[model samples]
Target: MTQRLPFLDRLAVPAIAAPMLRVSGIELVSAACRAGVVGAFPTANAESLEAFAGWMARLNDEAAAAREAGTAHAPWCPNLIMRRDPARVRAEVELIVRHRAELVITSVGSPAAVIPALHDGGCLVLADVASVHHAERAIEAGADGLVLLTAGAGGHTGWANPFAFVRAVRAFFDGPLVLAGGLPDGVALRAATVLGCDLGSMGTRFIATEQSLASAPYKKMLAASSLDDVMTTRAFTGLPANFLRPSVVNAGLDPGGTRRDGVGAGGAPALRRRFRGRRDPALGRPVERRALGRRGGRAGHGRAGGARAARGIPRVCIGLGFSLKGASETPDGLRGPRPEARRGVSLAPDFLQ
Candidate 1:
């Protein structure tokens, strides 16, 4: 049942850059491709189809440049969130097909809008799934591959353990498998391989890379932050996402005060003029923290402008091979934990794409 994906086997690293909302831009995508891995971005980042079209053009041009420069350019992919937004989905899928994307990652539903078009265009389709049932449904809907998002992943993740999840999915489909969420480095990538995944899915790791659009602060935060620094909650977006512990502390809420109760965007803080400005219980104030977000007209922290604003880095590129700074200088050959543990008790917001 091994389904072969053409062009995917050419990667130097057995991993794919996760389609980060603000981090994955043309430069980052092209860089990832040149670095020998699949690069991806989400359609939600583009306000309109016209902008998406322009984005596609830029990405393709940059990728071509990388190809001519003798770099290992891999295929680029766009993530499509198929909800009730049929018209939007249709338009983005058209652009993806028209631009000759090598892969298309669809979430929240089947690959109905773009799967056939991608197939007709000879593109590979990988559906994101938080559960085994979703995986089966995607396969039945004719997906070429599956991204098994386990718990502790940055975004929407399933409750299944990574090892068990991968083993379960392997029992059914032998197609290209990518394990997403919390895959920070080469060590995690190797773990994914041992778990029977063809490609490891990395998102947060790229956020700290020199080629990334993540802000300097975000990159620095990620590099110095340990596995314990991340928290999963659906406070910002209507979905679950991983965020920095400092962010929650800045919001003036006790990270461990609230229990993980009730689903569907209920735990989110109510809209306020200013969020609490410090995680330290002692240093607290209702400070007018310049909030970052698209909905409220406030740019999300580190975003440059508009949705595209979310792509810029907030700090200088501080490459930490491992989660700890100065812990390991070697980026390529490190093997660490499958699940990086955090000792602190805190909660964080989740980014939805």
Candidate 2:
């Protein structure tokens, strides 16, 4: 990649499977690595600290096996939410350092508290940001890189255009950059590179992959969905993010794109106490999204336990212009109005190759 980061050299495709909540797990993460891209999952996805340890052990084992077999694969990174209970966060820090994680992506909060320890353990820290200010803060906090969670990203997204956002950050920071949004194909990945990102961070695209932890019905619904079928609202977490419109409708919530249940000040506690009483036909239960990269059962976004909708998305926002033009299967997926779709994408050039 343009950044000369050694790990980038090992990836066949300059991309990372986002560490989504509930959506990312061992299967999805492992598959992404096998596909020549970084695979990641949120540590908070596990119900408990012990369960988190087991998940990490299994992932490390698989990665080690791949290495021993001389198979080409990328690294498995874990996303950590730093604003949780202090003791719990500290425990997670110990586990991460003990595992000797190669890359740790910190989200929703500052990386400052955990950076020194992670660095001490030889783990490079990449902070997730939705704004230029956050990017600056992350850099000042000694993050090794940045993941720009731009607009159109599902599960709490920023509104800045990817092109503008990357340019804004590149003005001061020249370290590694991973752009995350509505990227769904190689062309979008290439487009991200052209905009100065070293890697494209894709979450929605991996949801439908064969190894995704998403339910079959959810995957099928996503594959059948288009840009319009996706809805953007601040009601879920008080941060604008995209969600499947039909899913919202299925929850008996208004699909008119207005804020009805956003977490107001001190709203998290009350929301967190609410339970997921509604069962979804597509998702089986209420969906648990990466709300502000929150930990534990959260609100409105539908965790089975408590309705703890997180409120820490320091904002940003892509879903458009794509053509799955092998002409093999019906071309129905995330598409924008860009004219580049007709020609199709080729292998990435010098920077990515």
Candidate 3:
């Protein structure tokens, strides 16, 4: 079955700059959108509700100006955190609507709570889901799209292979689907479309770019890294996540273990750098070390912002071949599950006009 996602037609390439926390500010978001791909940032990136509102205002205003000038900008989507504090969530939803947001991404919780209000405001929603349970629940909750964070994804990633994940979801739901997991370049993006996903999501790839708000050191470190440097551990966020091994060492912690006590006596005592990377008890490493996360009142040893793939995606991935194909309101070259079917994800029926 074919699906419709009108926003995708506006993109020069079927890609998205996935939002990274503590990074991905106005400049990066705007840069990505202007480059003809959906750009997004987490609302939590702002210090407070007022700051969040300000970012929304600037983003919306700039986008409108670009469109007025006939620029190649796509829509700016804001990632909203809905995991805690009901009042804060309500307030956040208000701000999103007040600023005339085009699309909102709900993470860490269900989007059901804000769907009606957002729909009333003419805003679309995409839920970031890692499992089939979450995916099904999001659809039942009325999300307009699904950002499939599959295996190889950074921060709190899923273990399912994208092939299996996309196939299962496409069986029932068919909205604007995005496949996220180690998507670093155009070739990967092309693979996503061929695998039945509408968009290929890039988080670490975008973070490495200068346009991103990630720290300079982190960017350089990511640039020098390769797949062997990535370690998937549940130490930091309690969920399976990928991190740079060098980051763990820099914090004076071992990247081997994932216990949640306190660090060794030799560890940073003042700033209390507690990383999820634990030491092996058998290897004579201390076992009482707290892991990095907001839960249990512990913070990551440091802001070990991760980087994956090469840098400067918007600039480098422009003409590497394999651009999306549009024909008679249907996306060509989009296949489902090993090419047994020619089904693809696309905009609504009237999007071609």
> What are the per-model C-alpha RMSD values against the true structure?
11.4, 13.8, 13.6
Candidate 2 on 63-148: residue-level lDDT in tens? 78888999877888888876556687788989988887789898867889998889999999899888887888899999999999
Off by over 4 Å in 3: 257-353
Q: Which portions of model 2 miss their true places by more than 4 Å? A: 1-3, 257-353
Q: What TM-score would every model get versus the actual structure?
A: 0.71, 0.73, 0.75
lDDT of each: 0.59, 0.62, 0.62
| Candidate closer to the true structure by TM-score (higher is better), 1 or 2 | 2
Clashes of each: 22, 18, 10
Better of 1 and 3 by lDDT: 3
Ranking by lDDT: 2, 3, 1
Model 1, global lDDT: 0.59
lDDT of 3: 0.62
The true-versus-predicted C-alpha distance at residue 52 of model 3, in Å, is 1.4
Cα shift from native, residue 351, model 1 (Å): 14
lDDT for 237 (candidate 1): 32
What C-alpha lDDT, on a 0 to 100 scale, does residue 138 get in candidate 2? 90
lDDT of 1 by residue, 230-340 (tens): 544433332334455544544454444332222113233432222334322223323322221112211112100000123353322111111211111112111111111
